[model samples]
Target: MSHQAIYRKFRPKIFDDVLGQEHVTKTLKNQILSDNIAHAYLFSGIRGTGKTSTAKIFARAVNCTNSHDGNPCNECEICKSILDETNMDVIEMDAASNNGVEDIRELRDKVKFLPVKSKYKVYIIDEVHMLSKGAFNALLKTLEEPPEHLLFILATTEPQKIPATILSRCQRFDLKRIKSSVIVENMEKICQEINVKYDEKALKLIAANSEGAMRDALSILDRCVSFNNEEVDYETVINLLGTVNYQVVMEAASSLMDKSIEKTMILVDDILNSGKELSFFLDELIICFRNMLIIKTTNSTDNLMRVSEDEAEALKNASSKISVDEIVNYIEDLSTAQLECKRSLNPRVLLETKLIKMLHGVNHTDIETLTKRIEELENIIKSGNVPVARQSAKAAPSRQTAVHNDFPAQETRKTVVSEHAVKQETSHDTSNSVQEPRNFENKSDEAIFNAIINGWQAILKKVRSENAGLQAIIRESKLTEVVNKKAVFEFDPKFTFHINAANQPKNRQKFKDVISSFVNDNCEVEFISKREKEEKSNKPKQTIEDIYEDLKNEFGEEIVEFKQED
Candidate 1:
């Protein structure tokens, strides 16, 4: 006999055989048992979740010659005929290929006739969303008022694309993706039934690779079986599926955590030499980081990952050495690299750069440490362990000025003064020279500008610390001017709307508090457009309640509350 695909050969023959969809199966069973089945039924979910298979089972159950409870007796001729696709009463159509209006018109005309050899004439349409709009319109009336002996089963992965009119005529049931554990368990059972020897680790690898698709898992197992002739090993499974082994991923993660760029690069090179895809490597790295983050953040690992017990324990050990923040940074870097790799001509270079960055950039330090270091340096300077350079420079001018005061006769005697006294006299003379009228005025102006700059810096720091979302919007805002207790702020064009929205009364009050604490004034804050100066003046505004009361006296109770804040 020719080889049959695992998904096709092992398709669920009955409701009990369906996996990961107990809720749907139970509901359908109840409907069948109570004789309350709808004329049109819509089954929607991801592929391989048994939408089409469930429809076939339902067709068999409804038309079974020896129906028991809600299941079909496979021994019955009707069930055998339906399974063999030889029954005229049960029609199965692929809407993807037969999406023209003429096909739907023929179906509509056929639904009018009674069942020829079964209790119900069931039409199972797979990929119903692929039907053209005209085809949908043609099938609408017939679906709404089909014969009692006729049942229409529409299966689709995307129900959103189906029209509302067609949806309204049917009862919809959303099937769910089969969980990884369930797929693994079912694959093991299938392996046993087929006399295939496999390990649990191999099954998990296949299940995880399947990503919640039972058919995919079975197909992967089938491929493994074919490659090794019924004795599937973990290595064979990985090689057949082109999946990175968990150990390789773990080693890569460990290297990253230890900041071992050499080891990581070697591992990456090895995988690349093995002809593994860079994108797939990146995807695996992302998953590894995600698992690490989960292990770091959560205390329980019951349902978090689908790895075997030993693998989970290994991951937990790896996760213990790294912090959650580090994992998050690593994931973000890899994710960004993945996006960039898509657009780059050479993805290997991008991948290498990203790995190097992840290995080096995991250690993050904040600005607070730098600020404290600066403060420490200032304190050391203020402790008087060393003479101030500015003061020493001033001594020269002081000595020159003192020479002018004492005249040429004392110049020689002044040179013989003690070093301390000489230094003092020099500092005094330098102070006198430094405090010239014009120079003092310039210093005062500079001091004012410095103060304003410092105040703006403080405001920005507060905004970033308190409101990250807002800070992300207003990337760089500069203090344009301070006139008559009004602070003018100029924002980048990208942040114009953000600044305007934040300047609303409630947020403006918060901004005012931040600015007041920084500049030592309860000043009015005004925002000017970046391109033009249309200053929004902040004046003491009346409350909306007050305005409402005034309007109420003029217009009675019909007056409503309305207020706008600038």
Candidate 2:
């Protein structure tokens, strides 16, 4: 029996064997069949998504005498020779090792020669990004006017590093990360063929830990098989991969959500003591909240969730106890903490500290709950069914007298019988009313306006951080007014492009979201040109946002980036 690793043993022999990359493979197969293949090709993606394997297959397909539907017939002598790494015509060069001007010069010297056996010569260069600048220049020279009989297939994980000149010459195929479901299906088929027993959950766990790399998945499965005597179980997969159970993380989240300090601390201790990495545990916690957020929103365990029935049920049950906003905020908080831990030397202490804060932290979700309750109360009051507080007849008269003495604070009005409303009610004697604005009696319109003015720099800095390009566009804008969770932004008329862009559906939503976080509630944003606001209000005031809508509307998504003339 062959003792090669599972990844090597199960490498795709044909186009159909490659999973989750039909977009790339199918296109290549079509090109091969149509004889429209480019002289230079770039295969770019994350590792182990079959960049090199596909290159080999394509090389063999091009050289095969008996090609069937653009796929190489393995039985053909040319295809079999390439498959067994004996074909000199199909050269596989590891650019990572031979990435020098001399190596490239040697390659250039050989390119003039015709194919030894096949109709065309193919050079498959893996890790093409590693080639030196001089080597890239030399390679560019060769590709500038390539021989009709030569093909260059370059594969790399970091395509950004490749020179743009080199990139422009090749037809680039972007490979995407294989989804967990696709990986699991392949794993199950492999397990059946190999006669290895495995829990489906175990296979899924391996796939998740592989992070979209098929080779990584196979390597993980190999480890699982080795540890579990070819009979892999869920627990064995967990232990081997050091992956924290979703249930365990869910329980910890439950403790945090419940604000059970002791329970949270105990769970943290148990997790750390069990030999799991704190960073990985943090990742699992982040993912737990992320999944909770998904389940909280979608309310279904569709393809989005990659878990078994038991884990799905557990996630749903845990998610039901919390609001979507809570899950989002918790995920954000955990992500921040994870970043902090990564930067800090004492990660364990940081993790423990973060967990403690999570236990007692004042939840933003609570603010949302209060907001909703206040809205409901307002609706009830507007309907003229204010829930009046019961008291003796004596107390009612005293309360009435107090209403006449002064304007009651906004906090006092939440009790439903506002002093202003009561005075108007006694005089007019009517329950019907227009919607009363919920403004803090102490917090005047002028006060809210001034607060926004004072915090303009902080707001601008926030926008700057979110998108530097946007900041460049909206450098001359500011908040002009804020009332009832609605913010008005004034911008100079000359920069109408910025306003139109900022007011577009997407940029407007982003701007509103940032303002909401700043104002601690949902906020609606309105954009007005300085001149327009002045013409309407008969006063001039300077402000803030877009190459937004007009350019987008006029140019479409292929943004024309212009450079200043020197």
lDDT of 1 by residue, 327-416 (tens): 777888888989999999998987887676455342232234334433443444355342323332333344356445656554443311
Candidate 2 Cα misplacement greater than 4 A, ranges: 1-4, 299-301, 363-367, 373-566
State the C-alpha lDDT per candidate: 0.72, 0.74
List runs of model 1 lying over 4 Å from the truth.
1-4, 362-566
User: Which prediction has the highest TM-score against the true structure?
Assistant: 2
The positional error of residue 54 in candidate 1, measured at the CA in angstroms, is 0.9
Residue 452 in model 2: lDDT: 63
Mind sharing the TM-score for model 1? 0.65
Best by lDDT: 2
The per-prediction CA RMSD against the true structure, in angstroms, equals 21.4, 19.3
What is candidate 1's local distance difference test score?
Answer: 0.72
